[model samples]
Target: MVEAARALFVREGYHATTLTAVADRAEVGHRTVYVRFGTKAALLRHVVDVAVAGDTAERAVAERDWYRAALTGRTLADRIEALAEGTAGLMERAADLFEVVLQAQATEPELAEAFQAGRADTRGLLRRFVESARTDGLLAETTDPAWQEETVALAGQAETYLLLRRTTGWAPEQYGAWLRRTLTHVLAAPLR
Candidate 1:
């Protein structure tokens, strides 16, 4: 059902997609969809959750293998590169749906809350990354950790990702490389 809804939402948009269409695509009953999700906004939330986590599994992003791999790198640069790749992959997958959220949130109160929560969640992840790097002495003594966290969070945001993709016509790999290079520069540059 989540997959069905995601596809429809991406293709037909949030307003155009209907519960019945989702049910039909998923080969489930309409009542089953309603009973499981309750409302379209709730189902959209589920779709974003599944997209962000990369699966329907009950695992948090921090617990996922890719994210853990980023933390386990031997060098800070290595870790940042891995983290960039992971973050880029996530943006590539979910940024479109995030665009949908931006468009639909005006009328959808739940979507507005979800967007705010998602931003906080993104910031929390970036904070954790900053903490992990600092713990390993990856950050320089003069570099502001708060600045790094906020900058990276903003750099990796869905809007930025989508804008770069739309304007520069860069592929996902290009975006990932840009992220890695940008962070490397940010980490090395003195920006107090």
Candidate 2:
């Protein structure tokens, strides 16, 4: 039932979707849905959780290449490139579910918190990546761990906007090159 509601929610959006619609999609009676979930809000939360979990899982799996490349001295530039490209691929692949979550957050403040949690998780992951770079002496000694992660997060947001809006013809490699060069100035250790 939850799965059916999620599909309908994605297809028609939250505001337009109703319990009846969800029930129809699930091939269950409307009374059953109401009895099981109690209210539309509960079902909405379930749908959002399910979608967020899926997105997180997919992104984590896709990022294995990034961890491998980074650990292998493949070049921060190259690894960063893989990161951006992998993110874009994930976003495009999960566009429907993402769109549903996006729309839900527009009207539901509670859903916004869930979305922020997702962002925080991404930031935490990037912070760890930055810390690893620092420990490896790849980044400058003066760089703050927090700031490094923030910069990466900002760079990622820009890359996402570009990819989603088709703002340019950048292939992932092109974007990654730009990011690495930018970061080199921002975080690279000064030459002795």
Each model's C-alpha lDDT? Answer: 0.85, 0.63
Stretches of candidate 2 off by over 4 Å are 1-7, 29-75, 140-146, 157-192
lDDT, candidate 1, 111-184, per-residue tens: 99989988888778877877787788777665467888788788877777889999999877899999999887
Q: Once model 2 is optimally superposed onto the true structure by TM-score, how far is the C-alpha of residue 132 displaced, in angstroms?
A: 1.6
TM-score of each: 0.92, 0.61
- The window of 10 residues in a row where model 2 has the poorest summed lDDT is 53-62
Superposed model 1: Cα runs more than 4 Å off: 190-192
Q: Relative to the unseen true structure, what is the Cα RMSD of model 1?
A: 1.6
Q: Which candidate achieves the best lDDT against the true structure?
A: 1
